[model samples]
Target: MELSQEELRKKFTDLSQNPFQQTKFSRNTKIRKIIKEFANFSQEKLRLENKAVKIAGRIINRIRRFGELTFADLADQSGVVQLKVVRNKDFARVSSGDIIGITGKICKTDLQEEKNKQELSIEIEEFIVLAKCQQTLPDTAHYKLKDTEERFRKRYLDLLVNTENRDILITRHKIIQSIRQFLDQKEFIEIETPILVSEASGAQAKPFITRHNKLHRDFHLRIATEIPLKKLLVGGFEKVYEIGRIFRNEGIDARHNPEFTTIEVYQAYENSEHMMNLTEKLLHYLAKEILKKEEFEFNSHNISLKENFRKMSMIAAIKEHINLDFSQVNNLEQALELAKKHNLRLEKFQKSIGQVILAFFEEYVEKKLVQPTFIYDYPIEVSPLAKNKAENKDIADRFELYIGGLEFANGYSELNDPIEQKKRFEEQTKQKELGNEEIASFDKEFLEALEYGMPPAGGLGIGIDRLIMLFTEQNSIKEVIAFPQLKSKTEEK
Candidate 1:
């Protein structure tokens, strides 16, 4: 007889009120430990010893009765173990995906199937349902969610069904913990910065704004932790770093997210060269020491951290890629001709020679950086916070780390001169007036801090999600992020 949907719900609810109960595991052992400790023990040995153990996990397989003996697979965070129950009356009502506590003895299964050929298992003496699985689950044979959109929408279900997803999140935790340990060992102080700010003056990104009812003011979610952290440099913190959320009103793609995490580190009395070395050491530590990995597959490129990274100037990189060196181009008219030759589209604010060089670099050079490469001496128009080179003010002492053709980290020698910084801010303001919405804000407070005499420093920022994507060998930013923003189902339809 076919039971209706409501009937099935009622039946499950009634069966969920089972009397077999334990408040918590007083002496529970992990299945991983058990398997490793008793792999040699046979069924005869386990029966003779009769040493009992208690374990609790979610059921991964439906209970099956063969010749009055019941069996199922139970899985915890550690691993999975097979469960055997004999003559348990309540066992009939137990379902797959239910959380259960079992008092059992370790043994090896002697089932007829060769697949169960003396596999280590446990014989249950008593069991209780901790939680019932109300909804149906995907098949346990190869438990997996079918739709990619649904997997992101219901992350719990995805995590339950996919072991890889669970491992990725676990690796995320370990990587962060290892980073904290690494930085702390280097005498770097981790500081907390405010999420809401009066100015979004950090990077070239649109800011998310919110209204404050009580203060009768508008505030922007911080696009970067650059300003406040640099303020700490003025306050005499020699080494400071911030690992927190950053908000940017930006487009979402495989490599980009609207909301993401970044770690910005600033060290006084250091130059961009020192920060570049630090960036390399940090990534090496993460790959070799922490993750026990020397190579990564990201964006179809096999990147090795063991090799010394390549360094090239931005103009040099563009020249190497397309054989067009901009060093000889002396003025704006020549740059405009080159831009027209390359079919480069330019906005009103992008008409300057430096901006045109940047447009050429983006068009010709960026994607060719497959391995770990640092493109330094960026055009001044694109690097507002970086110090200008003494020889030529057209370029700044800025470097961006690229791996797998993706931008991973950025570092630069800090511009300590308040007057020069104000000039840069004025330039940005002029660009904004000329129809560039992503220009850095003229942060009066940050300028005030710079005026109070900040020491010369080096600063670096890493996109945490992109770093994890490389470490985890995942291609999409969404795979590494726990919950990426998604369109609503109604909107999707």
Candidate 2:
């Protein structure tokens, strides 16, 4: 039952008072440490040693069988361990959801029906309530809450009760750690880029705008960590990477979030092929390091992270998926006719044949890519920051890594020509003027940086949250995110 505020205060006031005037418990060991220390120790060895230890964790479960003895499970972040406590007035009052400190000696417990079987346990000598639980938790501990919103709203409670949720978060952390370690080992320097910019450009997405009263100017939360990281490339860094948050004024869906995390990596003197190969290698390494295997299961699909991922051009994937010959789409009118043939809608600003090709792919081909595939040679109109192919000016030297029917990574052969870059920005400006909300702005400073002569480079961006979702077999991006944005409950009707 949920306790009232006054009742909770009274319970806490009583808990705060110490009758014995004893010193508060100081934790010298964790429950996980205790388990690890005695994991290999036998019953005879534990009895002979009688190791005294101080451990701290939350009381997750309580079993009352004998009149004088109680068995409660104590859980820390690492794992849970069994605690055997002798019943007393204070001990009997201890309930689940209470943070506790215990000083105990290690021993082995032998239950009935198994005379020779014994398990390691802690025999409590001193116990104190480190923190008392005031409000009651959800009734179900092992089961999920019926309201999915509650899971994200009260993540602490979710983590406390659901081991699977905690494991997904832990896996997310390890994936990021592995990324940093992998980049560092590969001689890539990690760098920090600005989160707020005068103009949000880099990817074709609307930005969250904010104003600064002191400066009397507006700033946009970064849409992607792309332009600033490229500025580092212009400043002569061979390889640099940043894993940061990006905000987008866009829709929220199963795979997308208003605010998300991505890692943008740039390597000087590299091409699109180099970035694709690096992407393949990095994910392969992450699979082995994080999952302890070369394969993982997601949505009933057993994905293999082994070598030799399939590579296909954007037009080829379109053809393979729907038998559409996009290579013949050389002009806007022809492309529109083909799109109309396929019943795919096109925006007014998407007047180029390349844009129409992209529209067809998004509508008909993207979901068909169920395995690890690199869809390369994108339409130049869709990839503003990428270098154009020398042989075909209509297509950019770019690729997007797709796995489990979701785009995980995007990359390109960097465009360093200032003149060409300005022209591309002007084209985007025209599109934005034509009511294309998902278009990048013209960053004059980024253009100026290009004039200083950046070398031919490769750049890649991976949505860290989406990758975590895939690794943890979570379908919604919210499941991997600890605290996702939700509509306000206090809004007026």
- Per TM-score, the best of the predicted structures is 1
lDDT of 2 by residue, 334-448 (tens): 8888878778888889888888888888888887787899999999988999999999998899999988888999999999999999999999999999999989889999999
Model 2 weakest lDDT span, ten residues long: 14-23
Whole-structure CA lDDT of model 1: 0.87
The per-residue C-alpha lDDT of model 2 at residue 86 equals: 73
| Clashes (candidate 2) | 0
As for candidate 2, its clashing pairs are none
Segments in model 2 whose C-alpha atoms lie over 4 Å from true places: 16-25, 39-44, 63-65, 112-116, 139-143, 490-493
The local lDDT score (0 to 100) that residue 40 gets in candidate 2 is: 79
Compose the digit string of candidate 1's lDDT tens values, residues 237-345: 9999999999999888889889999999999999999999999999999997666978767788888888999999988898899988888898999999988888988
* Candidate 2 lDDT for residue 286: 89
